[model samples]
Target: MTARTLPGMTTISYPPKPSPGDRIAVISAGAGLPGLLPRPFELGLERLRKEYDLVPVEYPATRKMGSTPQERAADIHAAFADPDIKAVIASIGGDDQITVLPFLDRELIRANPKPFFGMSDNTNLLAFLRNTGIVGYHGATVMCELGRPGAMHPQTADSLRAALFTSGAYELKPAERWNDINRDWADPATFEAEPETRPAAGWTWVNADRVVEGRSWGGCLEILGWLLMADREIPRDLAEFDGGVLLLETSEEMPSANEVFWTLRNMGERALLQRFSALLMGRAKTWSFERPNGPEEAARYAADQREAVLRAMRMYAPTTPIVFDVDFGHTDPQLVIPYGGLVRVDGPDRRITVTY
Candidate 1:
């Protein structure tokens, strides 16, 4: 979320970029799935070295499953403290990152700001970094994006490269094709080729008459709810969100359409929905291993999610500009959204640009 510029307070900073041949930290800040499933993790590491031309360094808890919150926090400290580590990326998202928040040393992370890349439950750290005046990336986790079956999505690779090495304005485009379903990671053949995909429907825009430019906030809706419940990171004064752009996405767990409505309704009750000038809703992920639906069922799921969001907005923030199905969440070919960075939503022109 955007931090207020108090007198004498340092302005929000985009952490230093990492160049080719520079060192980057790879930590399993959530579930240490790398220890349980080595194939995808190894593939991601190879890509970090061969494709990105950056050295990948792992911490003690990076691959250790069942590691304590203190252990994970220690790894984060070690990564940021190292002058040689130019950036940090999460191996994958998990369910319990909220627990690790209490153990983090804010002073250490603030002292050595670095670009951190992750999404989903890693939203905890992303919000944490923003409060410390550092911008964190909202997508491109190692096992999910970097270790996608076969080659990485060209769009994902290009966006990540820009975020890593450059500092400028970059446009975000809708994916021509996208995939939400994935094969079992335990299967040896899952990594032999790319997963199947379908044609993209592009984005749907509401309130296309005005432009909204502001600093961005928000993340996975479920994680944000947890943060709100724990009373952590979120500002006590709702004014902290005024004129901000809200970025939200769902995970593979697939909360029902009604659940989505209820969550946004809670935000509205707290006077949170009306503060943002615009909302960027990530493409809804429909299919999952537990409920593998056919094409028709998947399409219905996505439509339901869109309608649910629209219903909530109509009640809470009727005039706010919202663009749906932007490719940046659980969907394949994800874009790296700059958490707490400036985003320009040109509704009249149907374009989005983010300052890296």
Candidate 2:
């Protein structure tokens, strides 16, 4: 194994409490699907009011389907800069949130920091917030968590509640039941009940024996690739990632195993892979509108993705423990992970936990 001194990841202090009756901003930093389909969006808002007991405030462009990057950035600034808004939540993930990153007013956000919640395309903003020394949340998008059909997934609800209300170490458990199949949001029946789920195959572990704890880093692997290409928020020194738990997930676009391996290989060439002590691989998202896979095909796809991850780890850091099929990405029952927060990877105990 390659040996190097570990540099400490930057720490961002969490904000004060936002109790019931406080206002939270709800913005669509990526896709404004709320305009196209209001069922899930409305349900998500209702849950914020009933379950969380916080009022959700929306922006002018929040529900606009084709909102421009400047418009979205304005909403972000307004939400963060406002003293009344205690938190900000994205409606859903989209394809071009990277474009909105450049337009963000860093000084404005730094002056007034609040907890931000999102994932997928929101990876761009999460990374941005981390760079700004603000602890942002990696999961729990409004539509996916609050608006979940039938009821909130128990795992998701618990994780999100802890991340939102409490501040401490929270253990992450592999979802006992998980779902990847989609129900059409356009169909009213889809909102009448929860989507079908299959028994979880459980997490796959590699190099299990020791415990590794570190500050967290990384986001959707695809989004990180874009950030690297654009020379965005990533630190130039590989040492910046040392002693850090790198969390990565693939988006619904479903890049092939070869592509995933190539991405990690490039990072390895840059001397980035060996710096991390452990990896949390988000459960592979197998089904999408473009390429809908059956159960057997979906299983194969997930297995292939795991093999690709192992191949890259073998070439980079052979001793690093990896826990796979974590439900924190494009999968249903997604748990919230704290970006730039402390994560403990207990290989001996087969437990993964994060401090939010």
Put down candidate 2 lDDT per residue, 1-356, tens digits, no spaces.
11122234545666655777889999999999999988889999999999999999999888999999989999998999899999999999998888888788777887898889999989888888877778888998888778888899988988888888888889999888899878888888988888888899788888889999987788899998888777777765566678899999998899999999999998888788899999999999999989999889998999899899899999999999999998998898898998888899999889998988
Report the lDDT tens digits of candidate 1 across residue range 1-356: 22222223224689989999999999988999999988889999999999999999999998999999889999999999999999999999999999898888878899999999999999999988888889989999889999999999999999999998999999999999999999999999998899888899889999978998888889999999888778778766667678989999999989999999999999999899999999999999998999898899988998999999999999999999999999999999999999989999999899999998
Best by TM-score: 1
Question: Which 10-residue window of candidate 2 scores lowest in summed lDDT?
Answer: 1-10
Count clashing residue pairs per candidate: 0, 0
Q: Estimate each model's TM-score.
A: 0.97, 0.96
- Candidate 2 TM-score to native: 0.96
**Superposed Cα deviation of residue 62, candidate 2 (Å):** 0.6
Which portions of model 1 miss their true places by more than 4 Å? 1-10
Q: Can you give the lDDT of residue 82 in candidate 2? A: 90
What is the clash count of model 2?
Answer: 0
Instruction: State, as a TM-score between 0 and 1, how close model 1 is to the true structure.
Output: 0.97
Question: What is the total number of backbone clashes in candidate 1?
Answer: 0
Go through the candidates in order and give each one's C-alpha lDDT.
0.91, 0.87
